[model samples]
Target chain A: MKIILKNICKSYNGRKVIDNLSYEFTPDKPVVIEGGSGIGKTTLLRIIMGLEKPDSGEVVFEGVSHEAVRFAPVFQNTRLIDKLDAPANVRLAAREISGDAVRAALIALIPKEELGKKVRDLSGGTQRRVEIVRAVLAPSDVIIMDEPLTGLDEGNARRAVAYIKENMEGRILITSSHSDLFEAFCETLLLK
Target chain B: MQTLSLSAALCRVTTSITWADSLKNGTARKILIIVFWLLLWQGASALVHNSILLAGPYESLLALCSLAVTSKFWLSILFTFLKITLGFVLGLITGILCACLSYRFKLFREFITPPISVIKSIPVASFVIIVIIWAGASSLATVISALVVFPMIYHNMLSGLEATGSSLIEMGRLFRFRFIDKARYIYFPQVLSHLHSAVLISSGMAFKSGIAAEVIGRPLQSIGNGLYLSKISLATADLFAWTFCAVILAYLFEKAVSLILKRLSAA
Candidate 1:
């Protein structure tokens, strides 16, 4: 399956964020949207994920109905249920994943003690990791991550990237980051 | 020898002072405060020298004990308690459903505004009279209590739903979460916090209004009827005792509801 953005344009308050952009995202290759701040990387990701509409143009999903396409996203904010623990947060989106699997995934990036603690009580880096795990485990045709490693240190960022790559499972992965962290594994789409 | 004895005496004094300090700061302090108020009430009653006009705490307790042994007293309590609780539960369910509808649809919200406003503006006495006429005296307390509770729960729950984080909701949508998952994870915690305060406030209001309705409607075998009878017969102690019973019941019910809500949030 493939997603094609044809002449997509979006603007806010008369300022164009994404203008006349076109791209094809295929499952065969992972894509990393790299750009400086305010370059519309997040906006483009949202458009592709169907969270936001383009001002003029369309996103054509080939080999699947639009309704049949499922997305798992790591938002700019951690966007976790604050009252729920790390494993519970993942299970909210990935209910089919077993409890043991959730705990195993979480223990890679966070301490075992932190597993039962509410996501709100975890540190920023730990919360980001929880978000990553949630997206990775969720059953989706496409995974869209907006700065998934924003709060992580270099070691954890590398670990998160490696985890995400291992679990791609033949699904298309579209991520936006200001750094060149995913350049080694993902085809860079530098948004102008 | 003089110095040793002086040091021992100083230590004893310090220990005694510490004990006194702890008493003033603990549950002992609360007991003392209640005793103080009871004494003041007793003194005032003594000065009045009229048991009919002002029943002392002792007389009120005596009245309660006497009523407690009677089957009619228990029956009246059960009648009022069941009716008011039913009304509250009905109001709670209706309010939650309405709030959910209002939150999801702008048209429903607009449609509900005038009725909620009317309910909010009208007096409880007026509703009791209207309910008595429409549904008869037997159902008056239940209807009135529901009328009183509905608007409070509706308004508060609506506010809670409105205050929910939209970003999280959007994330839920992106993840293709089912309605139950969205409600359980995204809406429930937010609404539960607001619902807690609403329950505490509305539970007391429900009991007060429910009893007032029974008193006006003269419902058979109700606590409100018991209060009315005591008043008409100049049984001031009995009246005070009934009032005490109502307050205690309201307090217990509120605590129970709070506990259930706390458990729901935990789960």
Candidate 2:
């Protein structure tokens, strides 16, 4: 389903954060919202995720959208439940996806043996990989990732970009510093 | 490479020596510390020349060893343990329930705040006497202990729930997660950290306060009554032995609770 944000404007404490921003997320291409720090990248993502309502404008999603839509965030901090293992962490959504599916998805991204290890036990790169696997495996229509590759070496970054590029089948709205994320076959929605 | 290997091996051995595994480990160190303390206690007892004033460890152990064979002793210990443990369990459940209610409804939390504060500030002796007159001495220890434990746990859980990560909640909202998922992932983990510490303190407080209640209540064949008898008869050795039992029980309960917590976290 396509999501349309028309002239969305939001201000916190009388200072405009996301000012008259209009964007659309279709299945054809990934949308990247490129801006400096505190430039409302997160605020804009929060609005799309139904976390915050825009001061003006409306966010319309395709087909049977709830009055208040739910979302999953690919936050910079990973926002992992440290006590739970990777498989447990991935299936922490509403539907309770099959354990086998969770295990399989985690195995596909990282090693299966590490699936039982708590998120806190995993190294930084491994944790990020687990988070990526979690985001990819979740059954969400729109995945809103904010600076998904903030902490990674070149090799892991390439691997993460490759995993996202290869596995992300539906509409994805991501904010990134690496321009190479857009060097792909799919169309790009550049949100200024 | 050869010199580096030797240095690396030395570093490994040195780094492996953690304080937890070193300071209190092995019979040599433990025995040495025990002997030093025992000698000091014995010297003090000898100088006092009064068994009622201070009894040596050996004398206390002798009293404890003799007490262990009696059926009444076993029954008293069992009842005492059961009462305190029940109070601890009740406090834990009540605290969690109250915290959940308070978090959900501001009105409920406001209503509960005064009671919790009143309970916290009330003198232990005052409660013990009040509980004794109200409920009698038979189960006074447990009730008092539970009262002390409830506030710490209830406050900790409420704060813990309030401190849940906004990002995770936002994530849950984004994905349209059910209430159960939001609680299990976002709330439960956040609360468990503080809850674990609160439980330990609560358990200890419950044990101590409950025993104090028993001492005041003077219930039949109870550890509390035994303690009272020790004071009346000036049996300092028996007093120390019973005090040792109480301390050991508290320590063991903490260990058992911590172990269960560890296993739960691992799962």
Candidate 2: residue A153 lDDT (0-100): 70
Query: B90-206 in candidate 2: lDDT tens per residue?
Result: 888899999999999999999999999999999999998888788888878778878988999999999999998787776676666678878877888889987988888788888
All candidates: CA RMSD in angstroms? 3.2, 7.0
Whole-model alpha-carbon lDDT for candidate 2? 0.79
Stretches off by above 4 angstroms in model 1 are A107-116, B1-19
Native A-B interface contacts kept, per candidate: 0.91, 0.82
Q: Report how far residue B145 has shifted in candidate 2, in Å.
A: 1.0
True contacts kept of 1: 0.91
Best by TM-score: 1
Q: How much is the lDDT of residue B117 in candidate 2? A: 94
Docking class of 1: medium
